[model samples]
Target: MKALLGLFILMQIFIATNAQRVCGTEIYTQKLFAANPVIKNAWNNAEVQIASTTKAATGFAARDTAANEIIYIPLVIHIVYNKVIENISDAQIQSQLAALNNDYSYSNIDKINIPAAFASLAADTRIRFCLAQIDPQGKKTSGIVRKYTVKDYFSPEDGMKISAQGGDEAWDSKRYLNIWVCNMASRTLGYSSLPGGLANVDGVVIAYDVFGSGEHVRAPFNKGRTATHEIGHWLGLKHIWGDAICGTDLVEDTPTQQYYNYGSPTFPHVTNCSPNSNGDMFMNFMDFTNDGCMNMFTIGQKQRMRALFAKGNLRNSFLLSFACDSTLAQGSALPAVDTIAVLSNKPLPQNTGLKVYPNPTQAGVNIEYIGTLNNISKTVSIFNVVGNCVYTGKLTKEKAYVNMANLSKGIYIIQIKEGSNRLTAKIIKE
Candidate 1:
């Protein structure tokens, strides 16, 4: 019995050590590029824009002190499972969310383990995430969709993303960060669509066993950093080794290195292309290092991520995604595609100069808009504490009025959406 136990222990170690982090992002993107062809050029343009907009040509895209604020991303997790064990619990989902928040905000307790040489370079991305409070139909939701599939496993480039193929179709990609957790085929742990990929298939996919930070989760990949890493790819962050020998990841603070690093490499793990004693940034979240070994994203990476969310950038549409707030959901069904179409129509969210008045009042309220809202129909919808749309009307000229005398004395969300532009404020009806 003792010999059998020792053999099991050795087997566990062997499996752990032999397992490599296989991210299908590069191959997936290459196939996508081949299919669309034009997407490659458009993606290149987006990269050039990111490079041009980086702050001050600094080694790191230092936080925008003047305008830097926490950006909250709303997520919708599609769990496509073939077996009962593959359907992860809500606790596991929440655990992954917590881990993402910590790592992105640079609040991870493991930061202390980052090498002193690169510790100071880690930046607080000021990015946070939450499950969607509203579904694409504008109804209340837990933000998690569980669908059973007949297939035992899905390939990195398989029909796992399409509902017709037994997988759940993605919700509106513009308003929510859709993440699919399923059993990936082969040794691939996950893959993600880059910024310019097809909208219908835009998302990140992770293998079920490596998703959450929980005891049920397998080791090494179990810390929930797989999402963090794949999301980096979704947000336009390249692998630390740039997917090539001594390649560039487009981030300056990160040292140039030859190929990717596996397992926990020692400090100053110099590569053939190492420029200095401080070698490859094998500990970066973008590297293929074990989840426990990866701890931080350099300031340069934070900048690259931020560049996509800047004004008129690729990811700026997320700013108007009120799906994170439950109270904004519609009482009736509204197809997600229509809402997303409106979201995609705008050039960029412009300052609408919108205002809501008569707070804590006995009578009605006045919503005023003083910007380019003439041709575009700006509709105002009011909702109570619950996610029920109480009243809906159109904004005429520059202002619209809604009678609230019958409304109970309480707070309400006054929301106005015109194309992708949205104006929202809280008002009291007394």
Candidate 2:
């Protein structure tokens, strides 16, 4: 009788402990859900809007045709550290980027060892993630911004601060997508505020451990997939299960699961959805799988991500047709052209001769032009390689002072335009 009582007591303790663990995890996730309600709601609403808008815009009877368009997301990584990891090296950043591109493009599955039963569902996201080579105003950049902060670890709110700092310090939210990488709170790998959200600060925050350079990081989580998952959120995707059993992730194909999974899950694990004869999609990136084990984003999830690139704030800033074309043209530019001309619709009238003095200026550049009084209403636009507009102003006089002291040593373009004539001059800021 004593043995039976002892066994019962131990069993109760085990069950209680498991319940507490589960509850704790839920509490942490709830904090994320509550703090980022804006993004959560926007994602839900965007799905409805996308469904209706795509149907109307494509004039097609099916969802697949509308989703076929390839999506290109330009990324900017902000590395905030306290010298522990003196900002992940560029090579490390590149590695993480490669991982993202492979996963989203469905190329990573080639590395996976899959059983025959679940093989047919394999999908390529048709989405590409690239470091922003050109900024919003058409300026060239490395796309990695590093800052030193005193704080040990950043909270979700602190994450917002870092992103805002990036925006203020040369990061362009309109063209280059911002990603904040820091040592965030304990037990938190990463969290993202989706597009069109209240905290939609145009960035995603990831914990250092899950980022690149796994030297000081732990196993089962160090392969940089944390950034991958957070980026999915940034692109308007939700957890595969939508955080509840009955809740839909809004993807038509992904199976509904009751809980999140950690570590590597064994094959053939059955679930309520019984999606495939094999079982639940615990190995999907949207799920909480170990980095090495998580390799695919489902076809449905891919459609949703592509759909996001089709509308809203992201589309306006990052998906403009001109921006896309420029990106491609610049990417293909070899031997690096000394000067490239970008003309606005309105050009300066004939007889306007624009001159930029000291072609390579150390202190400041002076602009002189001979034109009619209509030039007073014209504008001067300066851009760098990545499409970042460094300066813009209406022409007050034929002469303007362009301070170059604080500017980095690089090639810059200055354009002067009036009614029908446009002139471009290349100036080197040294």
Candidate 3:
């Protein structure tokens, strides 16, 4: 027992000293470029396009409207686990998604912690994330896939992304953000593929301990910012230091940073490279700070991300996706061509046709709908405030139990559709 306790203490010491917040983005990029020569051409072309866009939008006077447009990215988490604890709970996954949505859009409560000097530079990015409701085969999903594995852990080169290698195969890369969570071999925390890479291997891989917030998350990295930082790379933002001493991240507003900052540094922490400026933006999400310390993404970084989703850009396909629509339940096979057309425009009466009583439900609510046809395939979808369909099913009769017991407390839209008739109602989960 003494020996086991000592070993556990030693493990804690190792994790503290080598937190592995260092992203393997550049490392994976180098490996991919070497393995597949064609990737270099695509990456270079992407850079050229970004540069051209920047040139055209030079100076804040042009005042880009890109920030005004809200874009939602569908995410699917693949949990490859060896132990029972590694198969994290849905609440934990939801917590991480909440963190990503909040942090990426500058809605994080920690924004108040950022120094006043850097406040204006913080950007909303107008980006939101939702766990996919529609599977690639056009079936309903919880947006989480769990696979028990014999392998204790996985490494970057081990292809934790390949199903044949004891990892979950990625969903379609262009339409969804795929994240693999598992026990990482060695001290590595996480890694992500940059915007341009082989389609099959394109996504982010994060260690389970740092993948989310609350119960399953570990100390120092528990704020769930690890995934946020990695997704930043996946969205085309580089490290503030660009992985070198006195490096450039290609952003105009961020002061040049000398090196990545770790732990929590005092405010006004300037690097030698930018002695005249207000130091390094250590609190920026692109930095290597502990999750608690990192809070914001610069306006320049937002522009870079928005540019990637621009028309004709590599990530633009996601903007046209209909994966979260009610139509996924309309048929078994998705149409060959995807469309983002509006689903319905009919107005639902206030507590008339369908009644969702106990507006703020703790255990659950009774959804009673009247004046309905029988055996006509009545489908119900509950969308979160951000438009993510968290729950989907077919209403059996005139009434059903809309369970909010497991959902986080917030406002959600309950959408019911049957043939030509559609009804919408708001439900508050308390």
Candidate 4:
């Protein structure tokens, strides 16, 4: 009887330890699962396509072949908080940007000291995350939206509301990536419903405490890597260990592990699927490691991420305007003018003036500025709607002619600059 009781107690300890490590904290699992039912219902209703396990294999392979391309992501940050501490500052948002760019580019990971075994597998994803300089509707936005809500925890449903309201204020999801930062219930540190999941929401939600500023948290861990990890999930990359021992994250190279890890783990911790000489990859970004200890995304993982850029609907929409070979034209090609005509139909800022002459020209288009020149300078450059810079030259006092004969027949922009004063004029190549 004594032996049986001892065995029972030992088994219970093992189960509890395994459970805590697998799902993070108990509170996190309960709250996160509670939200899963809603996502499941949404999926069953055909509102979202929850990717099945079979799809993971094909998705993994497709991403591996197209890893070299660049992905342009438009980011929107929604801050929901009750007070200032809950409300992160703009500088903090910028800091998050700096960290994300570095991590995604593998810049920060390269700085970490790692064994050569893992270093060789490290990849620098060519993707870049930028604040939406121009929104889907062609409105200018700083890309940060703030909301004061009494609610502290954000469920997947709340994620939907925030994305709808916050994104509407910025760019549509069809054009921008939405990221919501708020105080999560103490139950969960972070959770992301995958893109094709039943709870298919179009943004990422991070617990306010884990979002930014080390002041609210501890060092290294204080940085916003939580966003980095969840964003990976949002982009379709699964946890590096796979959700379960029987499950696979779908990357060919990452060894399977029995469960996830929380906090900092020692090196060479062997697992069932990773009993090799190098042991398990617990320090991977997808795992729950201290920020200082975590580094690197495997080449396989990079391929998976890049695949989302290639095929995901929300991701591909942002790439339509970001191609590399596109270029803009300059003003020296503008047709020589006997007289300039200013279009007065459109409203102009006070003291602003614009003129174009030699309406039908053989050589190029000529532009003359009057009034305050709106502080706009004489030098002007041209670009197409796709933001490619083609030509640039000095304005020569108050007049500048952009040579346009070489340019193809299309619409172009004449960007005038002086100090901080910038103005754009549209011209056509005949």
* Steric collisions counted per model: 0, 18, 1, 23
Taking the tens digit of each residue's C-alpha lDDT, what string does model 4 give over 1-430? 5455345334433554311222122222234446677644543432122232223424532332243566767687766654336556666777788778888888883446666667878777777787655544353445665554445455544442443433113235655667777665433456565554432345666766667645765454566677778778777677776654435777766777766665667777777667486767776778766666677777677766655544443255556743211122222222111111334343322323455655445568767655645223456777765556788877765665677888877766666655433445566666
Per-candidate local distance difference test: 0.77, 0.59, 0.75, 0.57
Question: lDDT tens digits, residues 1-430, model 1?
Answer: 5455345334433454336677878778867887988999999999898887675435345333235677778999988776556767778889999999999999999999998888889988887899998887778777877665667899987577897786888889998999999998877789999997888889999999988897978887888999999999998999998766677888888999887788889998986799888888889999988999999998889888877887777888887888878888766432111111111123322333444565556798766543544423778777786656888887665556778888888877666776644445566777
Please report how far candidate 4 places residue 203 from its true position, in Å.
1.1
Which prediction has the highest lDDT against the true structure? 1
**Relative to the unseen true structure, what is the C-alpha lDDT of residue 155 in candidate 2, on a scale of 0 to 100?**
60
* True-vs-predicted CA distance for residue 413, candidate 4, Å: 30
For model 3, give the RMSD to the true fold. 14.3
Quality of model 3 by C-alpha lDDT: 0.75
Provide the lDDT at 16 for model 2. 41
Instruction: Between candidates 2 and 4, name the one with more favorable lDDT.
Output: 2
lDDT, candidate 3, residue 220? 83
Tens-place lDDT per residue, model 3, 1-430, is: 5455345335433554566465667667767888878888888899887656654555533333364778888888987776556767677889999999999889999999998889999998898898887878766566777665556899877467886887878899988899999898776788899887878988899999888887568878998998999899898888888666677787777888877788899988876798565788899999878998999998888887877887777788888866666456433321111001111233333223455666667877776643443323678787776557788888786557777788999877776666534455666688
**Candidate 1: residue pairs that collide:** none
Q: Which model, 2 or 3, shows the larger TM-score? A: 3
**How big is the positional error of residue 132 in model 2, measured in Å on the Cα after superposition?**
1.3
Off by over 4 Å in 4: 1-67, 109-111, 159-171, 197-200, 216-220, 311-314, 321-430
Which regions of candidate 2 deviate over 4 angstroms?
1-43, 51-60, 63-68, 84-86, 109-111, 160-170, 213-217, 273-276, 311-316, 321-430
lDDT of 4: 0.57
